[model samples]
Target: MSDVSNSSRTTRKPKGEGHSRRGEILTAAERIFVEHGYEGATIRKIADEVGLSSTALYMHFPDKGAILQEICRDAFSRLIAANAAVADEDAPPVRRLRRMIDGYVDFGFAHPNAYRLIYLTRPVEAREGAQDMARELGGGLFTTLEATVADAVTAGDLKGDPSVLAQAIWATAHGVVSLMITKPYFPWADRQTLVDTMLDAMFAGLPRP
Candidate 1:
């Protein structure tokens, strides 16, 4: 009985331990990937970051690409959730759009490593799963922007081709976030000041009906 109990105890994992370890791996991987580009961040390095053997790390993730995919997937899910809140709000299209922009910027700032990985890194064609994630998440986000723009145009709150307007707005938001992440050393206005200035400029250029 004692032998059997010890074996059972050794084999059984404490509840949530696996999930906690995975989170730690992801956190360490993100820091490594950000500090060293994807190519430089090998599985061994990531394993070392988390104080695990490479073989043990492989038990959790098949390869570095899987880790990247998981990171992107999680980040995109959070972004979608944040945007969904604004989109679902019972507010004017213009208001919703502004809130979405704020949320997008906030997400970038909140998850700088994930943001850089998703946006700054070149697409990894080898990772089909990651590519699929990018397509699905990116497409959904863009569609929401387009639909919001269409609604605004329909309501006579703004005037422009919905597709073009949505693309422009996305590009502008991307630019703002990318610059803020990459050029932190540059002397710039306060974050909210920059966001407000950009939104005001964009709204002014976009014709109102």
Candidate 2:
């Protein structure tokens, strides 16, 4: 009985060690994937980076595509959560829009690597699928803006299609934030000036009596 109990403990040790090693490999894969991108990243390199055999890395993730999907899904879920957090039904449309823009910019800055991978880098087929996900995510942000626009329309602060107005606001903000990320070293004369200018342009184009 004593010999059998000792043998069982030894048998379980390798299994527990394998699980921990797999977790370490996955964490290393995420770091490599972020630096090199999905296509450029290799299983062998990830294994080497993690101090594991290539076969061991494969044991955790079947292939590079599986790792890519995992990263994309994880990053996107975080982005969706960030947007959802700032969406306030009770806030006025303009205020809600402001808060959404702030949240988006902060999220993009905070997760630059993930943001670039999810939003900036993609092949044509992947791009289309990502665009679809972006639209769905946008829908969450747009719902609040649309409702706010409806309120604005009722209050006579806006006019015309609320849908169009919502898209227009999204475009304006996206342009500014995307540019900021894509051209980090851009010699814009004044960053704050540009932001203020864009806001002014947005308000100017808004419905007026």
lDDT score for candidate 2 against the true structure: 0.63
Please give the lDDT score at residue 89 for candidate 1: 92
**Each prediction's whole-model lDDT (CA):** 0.78, 0.63
The prediction achieving the highest TM-score against the true structure is: 1
Error of 1 at 54 (Å): 1.0
> Per-residue alpha-carbon lDDT of model 1 for 1-209, expressed as tens digits?
00111122122245557776677677776667777777888988777666677897788899888998888888888888888888889999999998888888888888887887777776653253456677879788878878988989999999989999989998998999999988999998999899889988987788777
Deviating ranges (above 4 Å) for candidate 1:
1-16, 124-130
Maximum-lDDT candidate: 1
lDDT of 2 by residue, 1-209 (tens): 00111122111125558866655555555556556766667888767765667786677788766665555566667656765665645766566666666666666656555565556666652452445555565466567667666767776777878888878877787678678867879886576677768877787788754
Off by over 4 Å in 2: 1-37, 50-52, 125-132, 135-148, 188-197
Instruction: For each candidate in turn, give its C-alpha RMSD to the true structure in angstroms.
Output: 8.1, 9.9
State TM-scores per candidate: 0.88, 0.66
Model 2: pairs clashing at backbone N, Cα or C within 3 Å: none
Query: Counting only residues 3 or more apart in sequence or on different chains, how many pairs clash (N, Cα, C under 3 Å) in candidate 2?
Result: 0
Give candidate 2's root-mean-square deviation (CA, Å): 9.9
